[model samples]
Target: MTTTILAIFALVYLGMILGGLPFLQLDRTGVALLGAIALISLDAVSLQDAVAAVHLPTVILLFSFMVVSAQMRLGGFYSWATRGMANLPVSPPWLLGLLILMSGALSAVFSNDIVCLAVAPILAEACIRRQLNPVPFLLGLACAANIGSAATLIGNPQNILIGQTLQLSFAGYLQQAMLPVLLGLAACWAIICWQSRGNWQSSAPLPATPQLRSSDEQALDRWQSLKGLAVAAALLGLFLFSPLPHEQLALTGAGLLLMSRKLHSARMLGLVDWEVLVLFAGLFVVNHALQGTGLPATAVAWLAAQGVQLSEPWTLFGATFVLSNIISNVPAVMLLLPVASHELAGSMLALVSTMAGNLLIVGSIANILVVDAAARHGIQIDWRRHARVGIPVTLATLLICAAIFALRL
Candidate 1:
């Protein structure tokens, strides 16, 4: 049973690295689900044990926030914000700064992926109208979204997992992460600015009138938007001051949002990404079964005996970077979570693992989504252009974060 579980574990994580077995026609989520089924069929883990391994709080918290972001998206808040930002007549440098700040701020509150999705189309259109280069702004949206999501526990799936697994304080994690996030956003802007200094002036003429769509031009529900904003603000305040569990507070807020008459309960529920929740639950069980086989701890001990330690922050940071780039961030976090401690090591691991996604277009799902959206609109963001900003920005921000961790922790 032990050997079988270990074999399943190795194959599952290998699937994670390769994104699936070669020519297997499966994704990370499919691989995780299969691994869990294998463990159950082999009796390596009972059904009850699999249920116990899945973390409900993390899953619920993630689901609740997705609802919140969906409400904002439906309300046209993102479009409103991006349109306002692009309408400004500032120079290219200031416009880049605006894009960075806006992307980071919105992503800190909402899912970075959604933020990019909502804003990218309008940003592309705005650039075309202004005759400005859309490539820099598009890359800014992706990098800023990735960097900004690091600011809070609720910002991304991996952060939520890290927070719940380690029982990290919401406010405390924010305090520890805000500096790096802010610095990282600035660094992103600096790199893009330097790269596009000569190309600042667009040769294309601004359109006679901005060609916004009817759907895009529809006014946001001021009341619904205000109410959702209020609920989100209250949740953040509770995170800072109240002793209530964050998951409970967030769930309550989601419940309140569902009770609204203007938006159907089913509609809001439909917006939840059920597949992602399933993926988390399935991976949790699979990883738990593998941990039960004693291989992970034994490996850690063996490495320690050789004067290497995975528990060290820097070591974990490096491991996480490589794992994240290979398997994607969420699965990488799942694999690393058992060995993580909530101190500087875990915090650094979470931040570095996420920031590493900015290194390549495929390094993060958000980047891929943005690229797909751009291509659909006849805007191609090739690898060379993306790397011009992604590589330097990722390296600079990761270094800044590493430095901050060394000095502060």
Candidate 2:
């Protein structure tokens, strides 16, 4: 049973690193789900244990916010906001700064990946319309969303897990993280602006891509948008001020959004990223099974004797930055959470793992979604194009965060 569990764990994480198994149609989510199933089917874990392994509060909180983001997306709020930013009459550099700030703020409240998915195509179209290069702006959107999501515990999936697992205070985390998040956004803006100085204009005559040329900007329903915003705002207030259980509060907000008379429940629920939810459930089970095997504990003991203390903020920070890039943020956070008992452990893991996503195109889902959105509109932003911005943006944000952590340490 132990051998099977370890084997399955290794294979699943390998799939995560490669984004999928070779010659298989499985994505990272599918890979995780399969590992969980294998563990149960092989009798390595009881069905009850598997179910118990999933942290219900984190899953519920994550699901509730997905529903909230779906409400905003279906009402065309993201599209409306993004288009408005793109159309502002300002210089390209100023326009870029505003885009960074806008996307960053939105990601702090909503799902960063969903924010990028909804905003990217609209941004691509807007850039084309202005005869400006869309690559840097798209990169800016991805980087800003990543950095801004680090500002709040509920900002991104990994942060959500770290906060719930460690029970970090919402307002307390906000206070510690906001400054670094702001400075990271500033650095992102400066880096993109510096790199795209003479290249802001479209270098070639862009072909008439239908997605970019289409006039069907999503119809923004004022009433629905207002309702969603009000619910979200109330939830944020409750998160900061109320002592209510976060999952319960978030679930209630989702229920209210689902009860909408105008937006059918199916549409709102359908927009939810079920794959991500499944991914979380699968990873929880696998990680739990590994913990049951005692190897993780043994490994930590050996590492401690070797002078590599994971509980220290500096070591955890480096491990998180490295592992987040290697196996993605959520899995890395899970692997590190056991030893993350330091006073500042939650904030350290959340901020470092998120900002690390800007280091490469594959580092964050937002980055990948933006690249795919650009591709659909005939604007190709290859790895090279993204790395030019990602590398520097990631380095700057991580540096600022590390410096702040140093002061605390």
Top TM-score model: 2
The residue ranges of model 2 lying beyond 4 angstroms of the native Cα positions read 212-217
The C-alpha RMSD in Å for every predicted model, in order, reads 2.4, 1.4
lDDT of 1: 0.84
Instruction: Evaluate all candidate structures by whole-model CA lDDT and list the values in order.
Output: 0.84, 0.92
TM-score of every model versus the real structure:
0.94, 0.98
Which candidate number has the best lDDT? Answer: 2
Stretches > 4 Å off in candidate 1: 201-218
Q: For model 2, state the Cα shift of residue 294 in Å.
A: 0.4
Clashes by residue pair, model 1: none
